[model samples]
Target: MNIIIWNCRGVLKPSFKKRVGDLVQNHNPAILVVMETRVGGDKAREITNLLPFDGAIHTNTIGYAGGLWVLWNTDRVEIALLSKTEQEIHTEVKVRLTNLSWILSAVYASPRNAERQVLWENLMSVADLHNMPWVIAGDFNEPLLSEDKFGGRAVSVNRSLLFKECLDKCNMLDIGFAGPRFTWSNRREVQALIQERIDRFFVNPSWCVMYPNAKITHLTRCHSDHCPVLLEMQPRIQNGRSRPFRF
Candidate 1:
């Protein structure tokens, strides 16, 4: 199955639906995570209902800032909400008609360093609790390595160090990607442009063993400053059924 994660910036734009439809048509993701929705309440619910998904769960936007929506089709997989904060959503995903299961965390980290520290701490807590095959992906808003940014002030040492420490402690490894190295850009003139590979997928070792053929791609950026990331896994045949996930 395919899982798509995108920092769409806002879902209220006129082209939002079309962009989403294109994504669905092109990728056919079983699970889709939209970050920085910037809309909430009844309006958010109404918009989500119009999407071509069977079910969804969301975190409301705080004022005009962050919001997150995790949408899925029940026929593809069964997703059970585990926990959530404004910065993250944890879920257990079981591929339909198969015994395969795993944990998926969709993250939309804050741009502020202090708040990001809190996100790190919370993820550590999650790491301490679960030992399942796990995949954590989204817009971290902070580059994990110096090479992850270009034409911008260097990544902060203290912040990147903390982020590295969190990954070390959590035993999560970056799965890497195909396509463009950077997933986000400032969209400014070349002389003033800033780009970073802030969006990514990190998987625990067990997850690697489960879907050894899993691959990630950084799709071209369009409806948002950030690129929509697609994770595709090779299918595993059991009896006469195929488990696409092999989330």
Candidate 2:
């Protein structure tokens, strides 16, 4: 089944709404995961209603940070929000065609290294508990290597070795670079030269093996500094295709 993951920045803006509508019409994924929603309570509900499917939202108290959302086509999938903590939100959904359960962890890690460590630990714990086919996709806010950045002195403190190690321990595979290579930009002259693959998609081995045809799709940039990332997957087979009987 097709699944898309994007750090929408925030869906409250008019530009974002138009972009989202165009995206939904163009790709029509079975599942959609959004990070940094920046909307809470009633505003969150309003955003959900605007999407093409049924969804749930997790919002933070401080307004513009830590908010996440998952939207899925109600007709073909069943979704349940598994858990949510201060840093991340976990969701599990069953695809009707495959009968295989899929778990999605949409995250927004704080830029500070200390806070990120705590968040990484919490995410790892949840993954261990579930122990199923899953994907962790969002703006990690940390780059894996110096190659991931454009023109800045590789800040040793900024790299997320612990986070990368945690994924390795969990046996998840990074989906690798999809398009443009960079998801975030500084937008300033010299700083604009700074770009990195801070956003990524990691999947459990089981899911990758099961859906061998799955891929990540990079879409055009909207109003946000980050561009949207989509996961396109082939429909799961329930039974072997039948050959036509020749007359």
Candidate 3:
């Protein structure tokens, strides 16, 4: 099964829609998690309608601050909206392969240090209570390591420490990449100022063990400052579905 996470910035422009459509067609993921939708109410509905997926769940921000949406292929997967806080949107879905249940958490952390800590703690609490395989993916807005950033800037000491603690507490693993070290870039004239990999995909240890062949696909960045991250899992054969007879 394939899962994709992207911060589209918003889905309002025609060009953005075209770009997203191209991505959906090329990847054809079973589940798609989108952040920073930047639209609410009817606009959200309209934007989701344009997606190739069968169904979508959207959590809109009050005045265009933070928004999230999840689009899933209904024919192959079952989706359930778990919970929504002021800072994140959570959902649980069952993939047709392995009949395995997985949680898809799309989060947009507050830039403020204190608020981010609270959000991270809340996420851990939820995971501990649920105790299921989860793929926590989104624009964390904070890089976990110095290598995750460019421009010779150092990773924030407090933020890095807090993020590491949160990952350890939640038993999550960071699936690193080899492509562009940064997922977001500053659109500036200065040659020195460039990028950082604030966006990430963190999965529970169980999920990692289950899908050992899983990989992160780095796609071209079209509309957002962050490039889309695709998590691809190896295909699993259903038990008792194949015959033992040799050809």
Cα deviation at 214, candidate 3, in Å, is: 0.1
- How do all models score by TM-score? 0.93, 0.87, 0.89
Indicate which candidate wins on lDDT. 1
User: How accurate locally, in lDDT, is each candidate?
Assistant: 0.87, 0.72, 0.77
Better model by lDDT: candidate 1 vs candidate 3 = 1
lDDT of model 3 at position 104: 76
Q: How many residue-pair clashes does candidate 2 contain? A: 0
lDDT of 1 by residue, 82-178 (tens): 9988889999999996669999999999888898899999998999998999988888999878899999699888888899888887788775677
In candidate 3, position 27 carries an lDDT of 77
Q: State the lDDT at 174 in candidate 2.
A: 62
At residue 50, candidate 2 shows an lDDT of 74
Candidate 3, 1-247: lDDT as tens digits: 7778888787775677777777778877888888887787888887778778888887767487777777888888998888876567788888775688878787877667788888889887886777788788888888887877877468888888888888777778765553566788886656767688877788887777777767776777877877998777763432222211110
Strongest candidate by TM-score:
1
As for candidate 1, its clashing pairs are 1-244
